[model samples]
Target: MRDYLFPTEIERLIAAAKKSPRHGVRNNLMILLAYRHGLRISELVDLRLSDIDLQSGRINCRRLKGSTHNIHPLEGDELRLIKRWLRVNSNPHSEFIFVSERGTPITRQSAWRIFKDAGEKAGLEVNVRPHMLKHSCGYYLADKGCDTRLIQEYLGHKNIQNTVRYTQTNAKRFEGLWR
Candidate 1:
């Protein structure tokens, strides 16, 4: 069984998250940010409002597992989604970027459930977990022929070996071997 999702599957997951009857905006943003920034579930749940700089269209990703933290550019869709989420958030005064309906900070388990449910709703055959988003990000970049060093930096991998897995499995690496 493949551990990571493809870009199309990621899109399907995001679309499913957006259709949640409750916490739709927050859930959608969670999946989107996690995939875009390659955030671990812990990092994603720990995010606070202060980490975001909407004016500059950037986000300060505080990574986990001794990974290097970095600032990532926010895409136009991400910017718009953040704005919409902020405007409609249930607890306007909450410090956390993502909160439960009752205004408490979201727990890791809940975050897991969000992805699990979204995956089921999306009709994906494989069981999906939150970390798949991170894996998907790595694989997606590798497939796109992004430099390994750049991917490592973006994903906050301190060791090149960790980043190499993504490149090693890349089908593009053998593109012209038989030609």
Candidate 2:
């Protein structure tokens, strides 16, 4: 909703990805996934190697907070980046989708730190976190005319009201037109 990162913030992340050190590639991929899929930080951390399907351009999300397991589609650059990251970093021993330098699953704290560091390096004015990326995903989808019911399904929102809140109405567009 309004809590989501501004468009400029997304731009900053993209710039950061371009300049990030090689080791930070996984973090960048996580950022993309969070924003693209509207996933909670907990869900992101719980992801496993078996969740993603590059060939089919879909992600299988398990044990979401408010809903059952679901399949989400990937599009465009998000799909491409994920494939690239997987190709470079996939490891048999790692059960997690994202791993740290130690080859262990990245913790929630580490995920937060990665986002914070990336935002700083990208010169973003606002602090971006994993949740904010999820919010951004919802906002963007709503802005693009996605239905609230569909958004609810995609975001795993148990209540339609929660999904409604994510649809940001454009004040400027309605200004002086509505009585």
Query: Top TM-score: which candidate number?
Result: 1
**Tens-digit lDDT track for model 2 on 109-165?**
988888888888988777777788877888888777777788888888777877777
List the global CA lDDT of all models. 0.94, 0.76
lDDT string for model 1 (1-179, tens) is 88899888999999999999878899999999999999999999999999999999999999989999999999999999999999999888999999888999999999999999999999998899999999999999999999999999999999999999999988897799999
Question: lDDT of model 2 at residue 16?
Answer: 86
Lowest summed-lDDT stretch of 10 residues in model 2? 167-176
lDDT, candidate 2, equals 0.76
RMSD, every candidate, angstroms = 1.4, 3.0
Global fold similarity of model 1 (TM-score): 0.96
Q: Residue 57 of model 1: what lDDT? A: 96
Pairs with backbone N, CA or C atoms under 3 Å apart (clashes), candidate 1: none
lDDT of 2 at 89: 73
Error of 1 at 57 (Å): 0.4
Q: Pick the candidate with the highest lDDT.
A: 1
